[model samples]
Target: MPIIQFQLIPHTTQDGLPYQHLRFQITTEDGLMEPQDLKGLKLPENVQWSQGIVIEGKGPIWLYGYLVHECHPSSWVGCYDPRLGIVVVSSHTHAVKVGNVLPIQLPA
Candidate 1:
């Protein structure tokens, strides 16, 4: 498996703290699915989605915090890191199992 890197220039807060984005894609048995199709898909636990996506110390450490923030589907108003990874699809939008798959969307 290869690591799909999403180049995210960390957002500088007014306080000068850098906030990184967590972008990743889910890997099914077939391969990495299209980001648009992720909204309503099912992913097994054995799926190799992380692979080389997350390389510790390679980028900003705050990306983990962004991942945690994005994981919560209730807050559907945040920016989706245009990377290859999972997303939090809200039950309010579709009839999907909340944890079925992570939402992956390319930046528009």
Candidate 2:
């Protein structure tokens, strides 16, 4: 599995809804891969998403979601699977930051 570092940059939609731009990078034997960005992800509100959080990856498709911090116990949990091209979020409450990892999984 590859470990990726992610940073969430804040943005607002034309309709005035808050969203984030997910910027991340992965390192491989070939060296550090190019940084990629996923725009307009409407994540949970009120949680302070951190920058440079490291996470593990399964393959070319990465999962972006929230986690529970001792200080931040969230009632809501959500995930954004780029492979599925959809955002799945359940009931809302307190929350913490977001992180993910991305690796190009070559076929066996």
TM-scores, each model vs. reference? 0.21, 0.33
Off by over 4 Å in 1: 1-61, 70-73, 76-85, 89-98, 102-105
What TM-score does candidate 2 get on C-alpha atoms? 0.33
Model 2 spans > 4 angstroms off = 29-88, 91-108
lDDT of 1 by residue, 1-108 (tens): 332333332332233322233345433455444444434333223322222121112323354444434344332213333362333333333333334333433322
lDDT per residue (tens digit) for residues 4-108 in model 2: 454454543233333343444454665343324223323334444432122223324433332322112333323334463213243243332233222222111
- Supply the global lDDT for candidate 1: 0.34
TM-score (C-alpha) between model 1 and the true structure = 0.21
